[model samples]
Each structure stands twice: as C-alpha cells, then as structure tokens.
Target: MGNQQSIKIFLALMLSTAYIFSFSHFGALAYNTLFKNTDAFAAGTAIGHLDISEKTAAEAERLLEEEVEKWKAKTKITFSYKEKKAEADTALYEFYIEETLRTLKQGQKNLAAVDVDQEVLEEMIYRTSISLGTVEIDTKKLAADLLIGATMLDESGYTFHLENYIPEAVRKSETISKATVNAEGSLNEIKALLKKMGTVEIPAKAQFSFLRLVEEKDIQMHHSSALSIMGTAIYQAILPTNFSIIERYISNALPSYAKLGYEAKVDEKKQMDLVFSNLNDSAYSLQLSLKGNKLEAILKGQPFLNKYSIVKKDEQSFTPKTVKQYNARLESGETQVIESGKTGLLVKMVRKIFGESGELMKTEIISEDFYAPVHKVVVHSPVEPVQVTEQAETGAEEGEEEEQETPDSTTDENVPMPVPGAHSESEDGTEVDEEDNEGDEKGTEPQTSDNTGQGTDMPAGEEK
Candidate 1:
C-alpha cells in the first residue's frame, strides 16, 4: 500500500510539471505575437485584388500604391453625343490612401479568435492586412471640363450633346410668324450674332428676350468690332436705310407673331427685342438663321393653340409742306426747287386670334407706331428793267421839227385831229393809216400832238 501511494504522488507531480511547461510556452508565444513582431497582419487579410499576405506594413503600402496606379491607368470614362465624343482618365480623381490604411489597421484589430501555435503565430505575424484607399470623382468639375471640350468639338463642326440633356422629337411646328425687310449694308455682324444664338431650349411658359438670346455682353467682349460696325451703320443711315438687318428682321417678324398676341417690337430707337411666352405645355427650342435676304426666327415645339389671322387696318399718312425762299442771284420769274418731302405715317396693328372654326377668340392691339415727315423747299429770283439806244434820240428830234413846219389840218372846226397810226377815209373808198405812210420806226409807244396841233409831241428827244 505504501509503494502504491508514493507512485501516485510522483505521477501527480509529473502531470503538474507538464502543465506548467505547456502554460509557459503558450504565454511566451502570446507575448511575442503582441509586442516583438508588431508589423504584421492577422489571418484572412486582403486589400482589393492584392493579396498582401506575409509582408511588412511598409511593403504592403508600396504594393497597394502600385495596384491603385495600375487600376487607374485602366479606368476610362467616355461621353458621347451625336458625332462628338470626349474621354477622361480616372487618375485625375482624388484618392484616400491614408484613410484606407487606418481602416486596414482597425480591421486587423478586430480579428477572430487565434489558436496559439509557435509556427502558425510566427507566419501570421509576418502577414499584412491592407485596404486600398477609395477614389472619388468630382462630378461638377468633370462636367465643366467635358463642356469645354465639347464646345471646341462643336465649333469644329461636330454636334455635342449636353450632359444628361438630349433633344426629343419635334411634335409640332409652323410658320407662326414671319418678317421681311429690304436687306442693305454689311450683313456680316448680323449673321454672326444669329450664329452665336445657335440652338437654345426654353422651358414652358418662359419668356425669352432677344438681347438675352444673343448674349450681348459676350459678343461685345469677344466680337466688339462686328457689333460696333453694325451699330454705326444702322444709326447713321436714314429711316429704312438706317434700319439694321437685325432690326428690320425683328420689326417685320414681331408683327406676325404680334397678331397672335405675342409681344414683339423694335423700340422707338430701333433696339430689337422680342418677349413671348412659351404657352405650350412642353419645352421648346428656338433657332435663328439668315437665309439669303431673309432673317428667320423659328420655334420648334408642340402647338397648344389654334391658328389665327392678323387684320391690319388702314395706314394713315401725314402730308409734308413745301417752303419757298426768294433768291437775288436767280433770273426774274425763275424758281429753284429742292428736297422732295416725305409724309409721316401712323399704323394701328391689330391681331385677331381665331379658333379652328374661324370664331374670333380675342382681339389685341399690338402696336401704334408713328413715323416723322420731311418738308420740301423752293427758291425764287426777281426781274430787271430794259435799256434805251442812241438812234432813237435823233429820230425823235427830226420828227418834232417836221411836225412844227407842217400845216394844221382844216376841213370843219368840229373835226377831230387824226392820231398817229389812226385810219382815215380818203376821197377813195380805200382805208389808209397815217403811221403806215412813215418809214420803218423802232418806237413802240403811242405819240401825242402838242396844244398847237402841229404834230405828235416829243419829250426831251426821248424815244417812246
């Protein structure tokens, strides 16, 4: 019995020694894993597609950067519209590398239960867990950049669609309005302005200003020469002559649309402007262009209203007055006419909106415009007197001497004296004139006899 008891105690001591040795071994391994080799990852670790196992943290970071670069190189984004296309690289985006590294460290800290084995623990301690940082794209910036590229493409004769904005089919359109004007002067600037307007989409019930449509400031800034040339040409010329190609187009066009109760006009100073409501439920796009001598503003969209007619009333004209001035330089009874005048005008533009059944829906007075008149002028001159000659004085003195020597006529005391150029009946039945008996004479006035009744009187040898 004693021997058996001793054997049991020895066995107990052996078992206790075995347990102590095993516990010490495990404690040492745990300590090594927690402090000695801190630059490793736990089991089951990965970053993106890279399996960064058994690598130091620094080494893992390098590998992650290389992988991210490769991914970015392969990433490509493309935008297409009609025949235009634009591309961008993902490398341009911002990345969060440090944040990803911190995430990886946190993930490693939350690792699952680990079995302590010297060989296994040593292997896991060398493994690295990594999380490649995320890449974020700046959408606004991307869109802005894309727009610049697209504009260049468009200017090069390519059609680029706006991001996320595509045009739909045209459901309805018509010759809702039209304007005509005699085209004169350089149309270059007007055409350029229309081209800049290009194609624009307008929302429903929205108002579009012609000035806004052309982007007046941009043109003034970029194409100042064109604007200045056009403005000067229009301003210096006369009424119809001064009207710009754009002004004439708007003036003529507005009336047609105005007949439909759409507001349109060229102001008194002839600044062109058009204000109109879309009226339709759907959006509309307006395109302006110059075709030959015609300038057109076309609206494209679904129609919501009926067709109508414009009733233009009589055009009343003001008569111009003529002014006359006397000029001494001009000959007597002569007059010079200058400057034919033009009459003013006033027209009442009225529009009658009609339904499909020809029923009048509304009447609108679109405009009451006034045109000024020009006056005419005339100049006249006065007349001068006639002059006398030397031969006439000698003839008058001879006639007076002969008349004093001649005897006085006597038949009956009551008989009247015969006047010069007077006809008297002789003994014959033939008629005779006293002036016809005399030689050719130049005097034109009638001659009178003196109180002695001798002959026709001559005053100071002056010719009649």
Candidate 2:
C-alpha cells in the first residue's frame, strides 16, 4: 500500500510541471504578436554588425546597402609576393544583398556574398611576377572571408601574402647591349683570355669580377695593362644598361688603349679590380670576341623593360702651359717643337633610362674622368743674344753714307713704270707685233709719234 501511494504522488507532480511550461510558452507568443509589427524584421536580425531589430524589410535593406558601400569605401586588399605587390579596393566588392535578406526574413541566417572575378584578380597579382618568377594566391578564400568573418568594416586594411617567389632556371638570351674597343696589344694573349671567358654566364643578382673570371697563372702570364683593355670594353657595354657599378678605380695617367671615362683599370698584383652587380633578377652572358684590333663585349640577355642611353656631358678642358728652353746651337729666330702639349679633360658620363612613352625614368652617373696634360716644350735662341752693338751700328752707318755718295743709275725694279712695245694678246688670239730696238736707260725720254698715220710697230702704251 505504501509503494502504490509514492508512485501516485510522483505522477501528480509531473502533471503540474507540464501545465506550467505550456502556459509560459503561449504567453510569450501572444506578447510577441501584440507588440511586434508582423511585416518588420524579427528580433535580432542583423547584417554586418548593424542592428535590424523591429525594422521594416525596406528600411533594413537601405541600412545594409549603406553599410556595404561604407565598408567597400574603406576596404582595401594588398596581395604581395616578395617585393612585388598588387592591390584591389572597391572594385572587388559586389555583394549579393537580396539573397541574404530573403534568408534572414524566413527565420534563417546567412552572410552576404562578396563575389569577384577570380580570373581578373589572379591576373593582376601575377602580372607583377618577373619572367623567371611565379606566385600563388587563393581567390576563393580571399573572396569569401571578407563577409564570412565579418571583417569588411575593419579599419586595419587587409594585407595577404601570396606564395614566396619560385625562381625559374635561366639560359642564354639575345644581346641587349654591346661595346667595342680597339687596343694596341698582343692579339694572341687577348684571344686566349677571350677563349677562356668564352660566353660568361652571370647569375641573377651576381657581383661581376673581371679578375675572378681569369686564372692566376693567366694573370701572371699576361699583364694587367692588356687586361684593362678588355675591362674597359666590358665597362662600356654595361653603361648603356641597368647594371650597378660596385667597385672601379682609375689610372693616374689615362692609357692610350682605353676609353676616356669608361676605362676599368685593373692590376692583379696591386689588387685593383673591376666589380659590378647584376641588380636585376635575370641571368646574362658576356660574349667576348676579337674583331681585328677591337675587343667586342656584348651583354646577352632579355632586354630591359625600359630604354637606356649613355650621354656624355659637362665637359671641362685645362690648357697646358708652354715650357721654353734656350739652345745655343740653334740660330737666332729658329724654333723646334720638342714636345706637343695636350689639353687636360674633365668629362662625365651618365646613363638615362626612358619609358615606352618617352618619359624620363632615372639618371645615374657612371664615371667622371680627369686626364692630365703634358706641357708644351720648345727650343729657341733669343734675338737679343745676336743683336747689333754700338760699335757695329757706327760702322753700319758709315757704310750706308758711302753707298749714298755713289748711287748707280740702274732701273729700280721696285719702281712702277711702263715698257716700250710690250707684247700683248690681240682680240683674235694672236700675239701683237713688238719693236726690236730696245733702249732701257733710266734718263732717256719715252719716244712718241704724232697721231697722223704711221703706226710705229705699236703705240707704246695702248692695248693692242
């Protein structure tokens, strides 16, 4: 009897609990129906952190649109790989608003769509990649995360990294720039060096060294002076392109075989070197060939994106002074040029890079050279050393007085006078007739005839 009574008590308590739960649920539903507008968004309807509680569908749509536009205006995505970077801003934002709103109105929750052209976005990023370089990007995740994580309105702009650079293998390419120098040296030795260097392959971003390429035995056999000619040719070839000069030194006296400002002076024992860096990320070749007396240096690789030109400007010249030495062996007023003077030169060479549309991109000074001058030398005897003294002057005057007392009556060739019956060409190309008897005495009167008729042989002073 006691066990049956305990079971009946438990049943009664269960019935009471069910009745209370039902009453509370019905009460809450009636309250919502009476207080809330049926056409409005249910409680806790939100899009992009904007509260849409108790707001009409049209009002919620306007607010969400404004929020989206605001986020887009403030949103910018930076996708980078190594040093290359690409950016996309408001253009990447084309959210699907109606679909999101319909789901939310049907008591379901969904995120707005941040749809974009994956092909176009990927192209934009990959364009910055170099010829022997590549990058990787995830367009799907990049598009969805903007709205899924609700980070669209985040003030700190998004910066996503694409894959690290994957470099491609390099090979020999066409010649981009070249230079040649005619040097006076042994052709066989230079040919040997060129043969050893052959087609030098320079790795991307490698520092170039002229002496490093040649062997120690070769350096000892052939002099640095001859090697400098080759270095100068290589230097000139590099100036017209976008290569960085690392270390270069000039000779105290400019060599006869090297270019003015482009000479790369090298002495193996002295540790002088011609060093430069290939700052670009592409491999190149230095093709050396002998053409007669010229050493040709050609840079073979892909062409630089921009055009490069070497311009020589800002020239200054210093005149050498004349040095004279007196020579007792030379006669007075005699001169001989023992040395020909040369004028000094101060010149600069610059590299100018231009864009495809003819816009100046950059300018760099390659070299500034100063060649010393050798002064002019001459040997001459002064006139004062061989001048007439007082005694010689008095004797010279007495001799002059004696000559004046005995002046001759010879016709002075210096005096201007007409000759008798001088030969002349006739109008018809025949020689005019001349008289035979010739008397050339200075005091004799000139003979003349009356104008009547006998033409004496010829009139003395008339054109025949």
Global lDDT of each candidate: 0.41, 0.62
Model 1 ranges with Cα > 4 A deviation: 1-175, 200-202, 221-276, 329-334, 382-464
- Please write out the lDDT profile of model 1 over residues 1-464, one tens digit for every residue: 99999999999999999999998999899988888768776654666445556566787678766766665565444543211244533433344555555567423321111122333322222221111011122334434443442211121222222223322432335433434332334367667665565665667545545446446436442433333333222221111110111222112112221321122232322333333344334465545556675444554554423444555565566675554333456675676664465564445445566553457767755434334444444544433233344556677877753232232232112123333323332222233343442231222221112221111112233321
**Per-residue lDDT over 305-404 for candidate 2, one digit per residue giving the tens place of the 0 to 100 score:** 5788988887667676555444455575676775576676566777898864568978876665565554555545433233456766887888753222
lDDT score for residue 260 of model 1:
19
Best by TM-score: 2
Highest lDDT against the true fold, candidate: 2
- In candidate 2, position 79 carries an lDDT of 66
Cα deviation at 283, candidate 1, in Å, is 3.7
Q: Determine which window of 10 residues in candidate 2 has minimal summed lDDT.
A: 436-445
Q: TM-score of every model?
A: 0.35, 0.51
